[model samples]
Target: MTRTSQVVVIGGGQSGLAAGYHLRRLGLDFVILDAQTTAGGAWQHTWDSLHLFSPAAYSSLPGRLMPPQAGQEYPDAQHVVEYLADYEKRYELPIERPVRVLGVHRDGGLLRVETDSGPWRARAVISATGTWWRPFLPAVPGRGDFGGRQLHTVDYRSPKCFTGRRVIVVGGGNSGAQIAADLAHDPEVTWVTQRPPRYLDDEVDGRALFDAATARRRALDAGRTDTGGVASLGDIVAVPSVREARDRGLLKASPMFTRLVPGGVEWADGTRAVADAVIWCTGFRPALSHLAPLQLRGRRGRIATAGTRAADEPRLHLLGYGDWTGPASATLIGAGRPARDAAREIADVLA
Candidate 1:
């Protein structure tokens, strides 16, 4: 039997939950299909030590504020997982778990979502599947031949696994800095980046980035140009551990190696460096392979979007991927307005 819904929300992560919250408010008949066996979604897969860049108050979804633990300014991954589980319960969002969606195809005027749990028909679909599943690894020559461990940030868990081993952490993003700093306490770690990593002022954090992004959005909406002086939230923030690592002279990053060697990596001048493990902190591409059947992808594998709605398919909306869909859509607090707007639009169309 084909299950039917007014809207089918794919992926039950932060963005999906936020969208569900608004969808409920509008009394829309929707179903959220999650690939995970449990409730927490991608937050369940993050490394144990990973902490939110912002405090709990700033890192919340729509409608509900995330209550931070006492004396803990930043919530860790576990806390986030618990909060997501609680959020779903609080809203009573209709979600089906362990129902991995195989693909979404146009069947007549409706969209047919083929999943492990059978076919689901919906008037509209929201692709909220975030980028965690699609970890990016640069093509460093001879990487395949490197005998030692090579892992992306997704596979990393604790620094204890690399204790006493010489490890190379690649990438200039916040994840690279945090992981490098975390590993430096015990392991012999080297940080590498294509360009020098930019560190924001100690006072700058996710809140500052959100404020800047809001201003830029306002300016763009008013047909004015935004100055480039505002720093990207992706830039490394001086968290306590990162600052302490800098004090110990362990936060310095080396230039990216030209290629990987059997036992290590080499720079352009053929200077070789030995390492036991290589951690690719490189970012991720959007997890949009399932959407490939729709042929909506454009340059750099990004779907052209008009206010969170797919440019090619108005019935399909994308949420929580990044800034392209909406301002700060990838963040906890940032996703609220976009999700709310997307839900309202979907409700109107499906009505």
Candidate 2:
């Protein structure tokens, strides 16, 4: 007989782990399937020097509070990872680590999840993995012809390697800003973007955005719906990054890439330049390729999840994903309510 779990939480990051903890707290039988060797999804992959802008207060998981801090500054990458690990241990969460999930589909009244390890059967599935897999690389003509090594911001780990190269970081998002700042340490670095970035307040406590998303979700839950969502910019809000970079003479605004020649880049301003390396910090898409055969709501890989999607398919909900044109669904702290809501739904399903 094939054993089944009440809920299968995918990915072991903040969302996934949070769901696991909540499920256990509600006395539900759930399993957390993580692809990485351990928790701390993006934090572990981020560069060594990267630090969160969100204060430690807002970054806490379900059971444990983040270590005391002097102020509202963000936590370092390692500290975030350590906190997550402690959460799993404190809650006694059952997480199957390094289990690479291929996809999830409905099969005979059960959510059949295919993974590298084996088949998993569950009543509901929570896709806690965020939108970080598909690095959004804008199509540039002859992009492959360039001689220099091309890598996305995801692959970047440190600036020591690019100590002498004229590195160019594309896109105006936080990743681009951080990468450009890292490259700024090298005098040979040049920053470029398609447009000037939108700068919000430097001290963007994600708690407010989280509350806004919760309110919008509650509004949708009620009969009166506005059909909108909210977003969070991690610990690195847009305003601080843009302002900090500008203060250091490191902000550039214009159409960045027009074409890629054999050994040079063609900018939209009709300027031709060659760089030793180009890091595309453009952004990422909802990484649902592994989740084949699921009826997603968008042409892109994203699942069209809203207030209803969460309620109806609580067992199989999407979190930390951009709402596209919607208000602000793509955020970290905003995921708390969804995580708890999904946990409650799964508990009911098991009952």
Q: Which prediction has the highest lDDT against the true structure? A: 1
Over the full model, what C-alpha lDDT does candidate 2 score relative to the true structure? Answer: 0.70
| Candidate no. 1 TM-score | 0.97
lDDT of 1 at 67: 90
Positional deviation of residue 23's Cα in model 2 after best superposition, in angstroms? 0.7
**Per-residue lDDT of model 1, residues 296-341, tens digit only:** 8999999998889999999899998877877778888788888998
lDDT tens per residue, model 2, 78-135: 8888887887888888988899888887887788888888888998888877776667
Clashing pairs in 2: 53-235, 54-235, 229-328, 230-328, 230-329, 231-328, 232-331
Measured by TM-score, how close is model 2 to the native structure?
0.86
Pairs that clash in candidate 1: none
lDDT for predicted candidate 1 compared with the true structure: 0.88
**Residue 309 Cα positional deviation in candidate 1, in Å, after optimal superposition:** 0.3
Local distance difference test values of all predictions, in order = 0.88, 0.70
Candidate RMSDs in order: 1.4, 3.5
